[model samples]
Target: MSAAVERARAMIGVPFRLHGRSRAGLDCVGLAALALGREAPGDYGLRSGDVARAEGWLRAAGLRPVAQGRPGDLALARPGPLQLHLMIGTGAGFVHAHAGLGRVVEMPGVSPWPILGWWAVE
Candidate 1:
């Protein structure tokens, strides 16, 4: 498996908390931040005040927008590698964040809906 995939897998079963960003508790964006931290130590620009602010923060962090998104792009779907939504790519099928499950998980098939957008960590 790729290092990114390995890192993501390591986070399985972590607890969920809104605006939380640690192994003890994490949200979708927090999980992405933690994953990005593994590759490099830098501020993920997460702010607790507003969730909408996250997109701008991520854009500032160097995530390039992808007009066409896919499941393989999940790890690179933001300025930081956050798996926030379901994506269909390769054989692993669909990838998405399951807040109830407290971690990102993959479904083995194409996504039922088209990807809205994507970004790659540069």
Candidate 2:
């Protein structure tokens, strides 16, 4: 598998923790930033609950929207009209920190959200 996919998959089962950005625990943004590596900014965590704000933050951090994506790309979606979530593409799937499950996990299908877009770390 791609290195990004490997890394993201490796993080599976990590407990979810709001505002967390490390192995101890992580939220969706933390998983995305961790999987994206140094291309992500130092303060990449977001708890704003605003899709527009989260998208803006990713843009400000040097990520750019892409027509399509591959493993290692970033994905954003609106789980709720006002709530944005982040995930890392894993080639055939995606990996993310899920609040409901209270951990990171890999999902092997299209997400339930209305995808806002995909972004490349750049």
Q: Which is the leading candidate under TM-score? A: 2
What does each candidate score in C-alpha RMSD? 6.3, 2.3
> What TM-score quantifies how close candidate 1 is to the native fold?
0.59
Candidate 1, 39-103: lDDT as tens digits = 22144433333324545666665665676643334433232233333222333663344566666
| CA error at residue 103 for candidate 1, angstroms | 4.0
Worst 10 residues of 2 by lDDT: 38-47
What is the lDDT for 110 in model 2?
88
What pairs collide in candidate 1? none
Reference-based TM-score of each model: 0.59, 0.86
* Model 2 C-alpha lDDT per residue in residues 7-113, reported as the tens digit of each score: 78889999999877889998887777777774444554344456666677888877899988788888887787557788888777789999999999999888887
Clashes of each: 0, 0
